[model samples]
Target: MDILDQLGAVREGKLSRRKFTKGLLAAGVAMTTVPLPARRAMASEGEQATYFTWGGYDIPELFGPYQEQNGTLPNFAIFGGSEEALTKMRGGFVVDVSHPCNQSMPRWVQTGLFQPIDTARVANWGDVIPELVDLPGNGAEAGKVWMAPFDWGQTSITYRTDLVELEGEESWDILWDPRYAGRLGSLASGGDAWWCGAIKAGIDFANIDTPEAFDKIAAVMREQRPLMRLYTDDTTTLEQALSAGEMVASMTWNSSAVLLQAEGIPVKFARPKEGALTWVCGVMIHKDAPNLDRAYDVIDSLLSVETGHFMINDWGYGHSNSKAFDQFEEETLAGLGLSKNPVEILNAGHFQQPQTQEWETQMNELFEQIKAGF
Candidate 1:
């Protein structure tokens, strides 16, 4: 079935593998990242600075403060993956702010498509985790960072506990397994997949730029290509497939597992023995943001404590705001694969390291070819 039909089944509670008392929309369904209706009355698209982000993040829950202050939610533009969003921006698509993970932060900055975010404007700036904001190419000047760290989480294996049998301690090798070959799914973006490929190849993130590391990663990715059943960035599509038992496991973010678990799916967001791919994604204002003041408000809203709780509990990501953890009990946080102390999770995983523009070009190019069975 097509993506829409799959999600339609999910929303209508028609997926037959198991019964989901709560539909996929419970976590606010992930859409195509196109122009989405705001939860509240939406102002004209031209009136407010647009928020360019991933599909699920465009929902109204995260925009509570932004809508309260502006009388309406800002224009929402979504992209299936970060690479596509960056490509569009590089091709003269100017947006008020865009979401990008730390893996692409340096390259996005090098494109000259963004400006440093003045931390003074973000009211919750001081509450953001220090390690998250301290990224490479984070602007030389203090208080002005290239990206305001918003949601951070791990990119790892989310597998079916009932459908698949484990061989030993969980590892990235699950995605490369020959037994689950045709039943595997994955995200199509290089940002997460390529880095995870490096991990699976036993390459160090700190030394991933070397020629040897690149070749080893490429060899492993090529080996796994033939085994994948679907490689799309759409969350609902993959999640529905998992719900229906069409695929056994997928390379997914923390949010996917949280949403799936809520749907009553017997899934585990595996903490692979090799290590999970940890990342921090946030907003960067366009150099010429149309509504510059409102753009700051958009960033501020995303960084707010209220949004932090939603991101952590509902979306299953580690929010930048430390205070957001106060509302949740330690036991609850552990269940979501998060902690009150952000560093505990961030440091335990393979935190991403930024690369130069050239490395990005090479990785993207090579990955595209590999995905195409080249």
Candidate 2:
């Protein structure tokens, strides 16, 4: 069945119950019927742009200041992965903006689901770090800026500090450590597993389209399967499991470790010797955005130094605007698990690359097999 059909069935309740249950293990959907007054208020005050992003990225605390300045919150929605978000938007859900990881940008652009930004309208465009703004290379030529970068960080091991010991730099080898078999928590779906496996195989992330890389990663996924406790996408649940000692350690985004530390959970996030997987998540505009001007306002507000501080400390990710770091004190910046020396830190990082469709299909099959306890 088509991915869109799968999503439509999810909305209509016509798919297999098991698949639906598995989908629940994927992304959370927050939607509602808006009254006419609310809709009118959005048009008059600010465009009610719905952001489809990770759970922490859409926090009330994070957006409160933006709301104070603009008078209305960007109506928000959350999701577990970029693939799931794209599936919903293409399945007929309309939202003015979305947050997609860098790896998904090529696919999202090719599908023409998003429109490039009118850079003139975004006031804070000058503050975005050049490297992040040019993520896809010469983005201006692509007709519209496909992304307005927000947060970036590595995918590393988040382990129970009291349980695991490392003799050297953190490596992908830790997830396969047999000592913690049956008590590990791994993300069940989405593109994370593929990225993790690639680092373990030492494949070049940006050029991983060959059959050789695929075979090596498939073997790695199979080897790690039995050690997993639950195939989950919820970071909150994953953190709870880690805190309770249900999972000794597992592959997770940097934000998970930040949240754990904030809650006083004994967890440590590491950047391994083989290089940690790096991914960037940013806001996107719909091709036919109903309120383009207001959408730009929300983007500018999010990129502001004040919002960047909250995002770094609370959302547990590095901001795309270089100056966002200026908003933090020396110690507060360190708390986000980012090194002051960016070049040194990025040397231990590798990006998640956009896969060709064939590769994605094979990857999904391998992921399903692993989750089934193969």
Candidate 3:
């Protein structure tokens, strides 16, 4: 069915909302179009906690445990990117929980809008991956932390294997190749693109805070800007563009490539020679959580093995629960670009380092200017 038809089905209650949203995403709808007010699960809306997150994450499969216990999934508010989500929460749009990745963790904490997660409250706390949970600046006290690690993965190029005529081995330079101008796409958010720029500029991530690194990355980004046909935070737009041969390549998370591949599209999530930008992202509770207990339940549910399995097999992300890997063999994991040893994959890439809020602002502003053709 067409997107309009699927949307109509959702409105008529003839289709599940999750299916409608999933169809929209696969059909290339921009994520920014998701309404700002939270979309509550049809049943038990009043008692549900609100989960603010990225577009693909609000589906019901991830909330299995919470639904079994509470009889409904938490209300969901979608954002195109983490920085946008943080901006909304900063404007006093309180949610029970909001998702952010490692690169922005410290800055989120600095905002003083969130409370640390009490490990004791989470049922899956023990099985959660240590390396994922031990992100820098996320520590709260003896046994708590700011974020409960959930999905972890890379931000890298996903290109059409059949269409992108490679001049050499996969690398970050492919995005800047003049031959592909007006046929390439990229994520607009600095959270992904600017870091990839840091790689393309050959700046060491440890010293990424330096003024020199900033200038170099900015220069590299500006040079690549004109080559991009589209700059979007929505995977749908990128996926549709690639699937239809409208775009030959794009910067994307693992899911886009995986989803396209499932449809028998020949694509590769590039293992850029420099390194893919990698990080761990999870859930953070609000300081004034209206449904405090349910918020913890939401975090625990995401950390569960059930959710972990879905995240890995379906989303092409690494889940925090260790046992989630047991169901799949080394070969299956390898096929998906994942491993039981997440730290191995994480360390193999350019793992994101926490930066001060000021640095994030400056970097994003610089990126916006470049995207604006400045």
Highest-scoring model, lDDT? 3
Ranking by TM-score: 3, 1, 2
* Per-residue alpha-carbon lDDT of candidate 3 for residues 1-374, written as tens digits (9 for 90 to 100): 87666656555445555455456556556435754234434655447899999886776779889988887778888898888898998898989999999888898998899998889888899898898887788889787899999999899999999988887779998899999999999998899999999999999999999999999999999999889999988777788788878899999999888878876778999998899999899999999998999998899889999999988887788999999999999999988889999988998899999888789889999999999999
- Which of the two, 1 or 2, has more TM-score? 1
Q: Give the winner by lDDT: 1 or 3.
A: 3
Question: Candidate 2 deviates by what RMSD?
Answer: 9.1
Runs of candidate 2 exceeding 4 Å displacement: 1-47, 142-144, 329-335, 339-344
- Model 3: weakest 10-residue lDDT segment is 31-40
Q: Which stretches of candidate 3 lie over 4 Å from their true place?
A: 1-46
Work out the TM-score per prediction: 0.89, 0.82, 0.92
Q: What is the lDDT of residue 162 in candidate 2?
A: 89
Any idea what lDDT model 1 has? 0.83
Clashing pairs in 1: 33-78
What CA root-mean-square deviation does each model show from the true structure? 5.1, 9.1, 3.0
Q: Which ten residues in a row have the lowest lDDT in candidate 2?
A: 30-39
Clash number by candidate, in order: 1, 3, 0
Candidate 3 contains a number of clashing pairs equal to: 0
Error of 1 at 284 (Å): 0.8
In model 2, pairs of residues that clash are: 116-144, 117-145, 170-272
